[model samples]
Target: MPTSPSDTLQRFYTAFSQLDHATMAECYAPEAEFDDEAFSLRGRDQVAGMWRMLCSATRKSGAAHWKLEFRDLHADGLQGRAHWEAHYTFSATGRRVHNIIDAEFTFNEAGLILRHRDRFSFWRWSRQALGLPGLLLGWSPSLKRQVRSTAANNLRKFLALPPA
Candidate 1:
């Protein structure tokens, strides 16, 4: 009577598609970690908070749709990868942006996700979504360095927090 990693991943994806932060949080281990270009977060509370913020922002921005397509699922199901596309209108400018990202997830024996990592090109993302300003700013070497530093700092803070 043990849960499979694929089952856990499926549940996680279902929760994410529904924007069900609580259920999504439940799919992660208490001490799990998630990382992407923007930031890294540790623990269920921090991950839940990140999901809440993202969902709230998406809603506020009048997102039309968000979907994930699984590209590959390992046979053992210890790991998997997916492609995601999100359509939303910018709250400030009312411009529509389509964000595409590739994500990889890893699970532990308990069927809880231990790590989730996302890979994407910020420069291309900024240019396509935010236009010239984003293109110039995002591609700048200095800005990229700052972004990485900020993400590390955020991760450290999340790891330092007391468990909820």
Candidate 2:
């Protein structure tokens, strides 16, 4: 029997907490879609690659430098939702960020995630990650676009690297 939607969500978040990007990626279906404030990605490869990149970045910050917490997970039929938070240092500025996120997911019949959307305040996140610049421009559309562009470029660079 296939795993239930709730079980899949639990496994995904658990893997994230452990910085197990491979397992987190496995939770997504082959054609999964993922979107958030800074990224809009389609297909499991893009989604998985993003997780791999992020987990790698988090790991380099040291195990004690970052933490993840998740709760309020619920699934009904093919849909699921969860609340998660991450406390970590932003590698760019060495600034500490405590990000709160709410996530929604749609699962395939096999319980792999078919779609994942994470919602968070970009202004809030920017304020924590960018320090003075964020405080001055976090709410501006230009700033948002710049962040998105930079994130996309970074992901592209990461994907270009040869497999380890």
Candidate 3:
């Protein structure tokens, strides 16, 4: 029997709050896809790796605190959205960045996530959270294009890697 989408979503959020990578990985279907502003990753392994990287970076930067306020849950437990905040110090600049973001999720049968997306404005985000560098560099069309392209390439590479 399949778990309800709401149940799956709750489990995912709990796992994320706990930073339980194994549990987080289990919440995704084998071929689940995730698209954030930074990259698009497909498959459980790739998504898991992305989470691992994010967790590591978060820990390293002392920004592991994640507070998720679920705004809505629907789609017969298959879809939902939430508002979240992440508080952390930037590893590169040691700047404390508090980011407010919106996240949405869709789950497949077997209680796994099929699609996950995060919404945020890169230009506004870069300028506000990232400071002068973000303000100056983020607005450059060339830089933005490069960032997107590089993220896509990285996701492809991650997907190509052998599963752990």
Which is the winner by lDDT between candidate 1 and candidate 2?
2
In candidate 3, list every pair of residues with a backbone clash: 5-77, 6-77, 63-88
lDDT tens digits by residue: candidate 1, 11-117: 77777777676788888888888888766778876777777656655665664654444444442667766666656664435656666778787777777878888
Better candidate number, 2 or 3, judged by lDDT: 2
lDDT of 2 by residue, 44-134 (tens): 9999999998888888875577889999999999999999999988877888999999999999999889999999999999999998889
Best by lDDT: 2
In model 2, the runs with Cα more than 4 Å from the true position are none
Q: Residue 123, candidate 3: how far off, in angstroms? A: 2.0
Give the lDDT of residue 112 in candidate 1. 80
The Cα RMSD in angstroms, rounded to one decimal, for candidate 2 relative to the true structure is 1.0
lDDT of each: 0.69, 0.93, 0.70
Q: How many steric clashes does model 2 contain?
A: 0
lDDT of 1: 0.69
Model 3 regions more than 4 Å off: 63-77, 139-141, 149-164
Q: Give the C-alpha lDDT of model 2.
A: 0.93
